[model samples]
Target: MIEAQGLFKRYGDKTAVNGISFTVHPGRVTGFLGPNGAGKSTTMRMIVGLDTPSAGSVSVNGRRYAEHRAPLREVGALLEAKAFHTKRSAYNHLRAMAATHGIPNSRVNEVIEMTGLGPVAKKRVGGFSMGMGQRLGIAVAMLGDPQTVILDEPVNGLDPEGVQWIRHLARGLAAEGRTVFLSSHLMSEMAMTADHLIVIGRGRIIADAPVSEILAGRGQLRTRVRTDRPSDLLAALRGDGTTSTFLEPDLLEITGPDPRRIAEAALRQQVLVYELTPLQASLEEAYMELTASEVEYSSHDLSLGPPAQGVSEGSRS
Candidate 1:
């Protein structure tokens, strides 16, 4: 298990983490989510002792990370995918890391196969692709068979199959009563893999709860309505704090009102409703709502400027 109490990190005049306290228990995967410049990476670094905390404390497996005689056996971290020697082969790199902890040569080969890097095990690290580098990083993290695993953006450069493989690996580790702490920007995949989430914004924790609870709390129940007279059905729900969007000529996505309320409104207006399906809120929607005002850098659509006199649409390139 990983525990942080009032953890804080400061860089000169800027503060990265500000008194954030949370616990990651064993036997489940906990996702770390935040926007850019939200202090997620700094927190992860502090957990592994990469950067010293300005104040407060964090521990892995009931002890500080540095206090462990064999640190790899206590916690395995993959914070950077390309932290290996540029000229060393994948197999050689693992052998070197395992040597530091007196791990056997057999274990090196085992991790090479476990991470699906056997085919390219003899290749130089500098020539490897981003996906291959990620696989190597994971291989090193699992080399020690640690009780707690901490991964930062493990799926950043992976393909669909690789992504699925990492997801399974995380869940499989948790099933064995190990702690899995993962950080990623892919909400769709995170929703499928994580049992709980720790959301941070502006150097402070905004939410720390189970996935189901956050989803249920962040978004309201919405109903998808299909009818012959779309505008008429909308008119029936004039007030009552309801909002809607026209998906098609005969279809509308109604928000705020429940299915029963929408059905009653349509029936009263004789709108001839054909479909009234309830839509569950997705993780992406819930995340957006939670971090709506917490985003440090907001992006807006760039307005297109007029073309030059001699430039045509097809000739611009």
Candidate 2:
């Protein structure tokens, strides 16, 4: 497991990470999400000892990452795909890393195959394509077979197949009861892979909960109820904090309660509910709603009308 307590990081007079606290437990993939300049990378860096926290504390398992005798065995991280020496072959790089922690060559070969880097294992790092480089980084991460795995934008340069591989790999590792903390800007993939979520914004943690809870909280209730006794059901549902619209004589569209709660109220009033279907907002929608105020570098539509003052068309380019 990973834990952070009142964590804060500052560079000069600017605070990159505010006092944020969160726990990433084992046996599940916890997604770390945020907009640009939200301190996600900085927080992740502190977790793995890449950068020190200006205040508070963070630990993997029960100790600081640097305190572990075999740090690589405790945590496997893929922070940068192009961090290795460009002249080294993928195979040689893994071998060198394994040597640091007494990991065997067999493990090196195993991770190479696991990451689908076997075909280019002997190729120099500098010559590999982006997708191939990502695979190599993953192989290096898995070399230690650690209990905790942290990946930052693991699918950044991946193709569709490579992206799918990363999703499966993260889920597979979590299934083994390992602590999997992943950071990604891909909400759709994160929604499918992560069981829980932590959202940071403007250097602070704004939301941290199960993925379902986050969606349910941010999304309007989308329960369609068809009933015989509409009046009685509406009266009962009014007390349950629902805004309803009559779609027909017997159809009700509810926007504040789950189907189960609606059912309970219908049952109490002896109303016959013929249809009850639940729908949810997409993860991307939920993320936009949650981080509506947290984005630091938000984008807007480009001005198409005319050039600005003192700026020529060629000068703008």
Candidate 3:
């Protein structure tokens, strides 16, 4: 359970994060997504007390991170991978951090094992690979067993298996009623790992809603209708609530109408209804539609409709 309200951050004249609000609910993974320089990291930093917001506040389980009795146990964050001293062994580094909060060495070992770093527990962190470093960061995040877990770019350098592991891990944490917030640029990963999505662009939130809602709002619902009497089928559904585009001789792509209705019209008109299928939109397409205008680097043509509707909601089946 994490809530951010009217968060604003400025660096001189440039605002890294504008007034944005979103909530990370328990028992589900909420994804934070945006293009580069979109202030995702800055927002996360403010949540963990690393940077104070200029306007609003961020709370974890109804309390600011700084006000928690044991902040580590209340919120565990993996903002950076391999943040420990390079020369120190992973076990020793964890042990040292555990000492600050009176956590036992046994807990340290448990976390080490939990993160699949047992073989490298005694090894120096400097020699660890990027994947290993990511694993170590996850280990440290779980060291305190916090109720809310915040991970920024958790799969930055992870291999395929490591990425899948992180997905499962995020889901498992949420299943336990813990708040899991993950930020990533990979749309496919977010599609698989998150139940809700919070998208930001130019330091402002573009969309904050359920994953299905965000995808549906992009309006890519198109159905392919194959019938003997294509003209009649098109005429029957074209008038009031539908937008039909004839692609081929016998194929009509219909939007704003369900497949069942299209089939019913064909059957009533004595037309042979060959096929009717609904098309689904990809998360990548939805994300691109939402952030196309706010992206900092724009090599693609922006003359398209609203920059956000460059990819029209026409489905091909």
Per-residue error for 179 in candidate 1, Å, reads 0.3
Off by over 4 Å in 2: 222-279, 304-317
Q: Indicate which candidate wins on TM-score.
A: 1
* Candidates sorted on lDDT, descending: 1, 2, 3
Each prediction's TM-score versus the true structure: 0.89, 0.80, 0.84
How well is each residue in 1-317 modelled by candidate 3, as lDDT tens digits? 99999999999998999999888999999999998778999999999999999999999999999999988888889986768899999999889888877888999999988889999989999999989998988888887889999999999999999999999999999999999999998889999999999999889999999998888778757898877788888777776578887778888788887888887777778888787889877899899988877876444355643555343223111
In TM-score terms, candidate 1 sits at 0.89
Instruction: Look at candidate 3 and tell me the lDDT of residue 2.
Output: 94
| CA-lDDT, candidates in order | 0.89, 0.88, 0.87
Query: What is residue 119's positional error in candidate 1, in angstroms?
Result: 1.2
Residue-level error in angstroms, candidate 2, position 274: 19
What are the per-residue Cα lDDT tens digits for candidate 1 across 139-175? 9999899999999989989999999999999999999
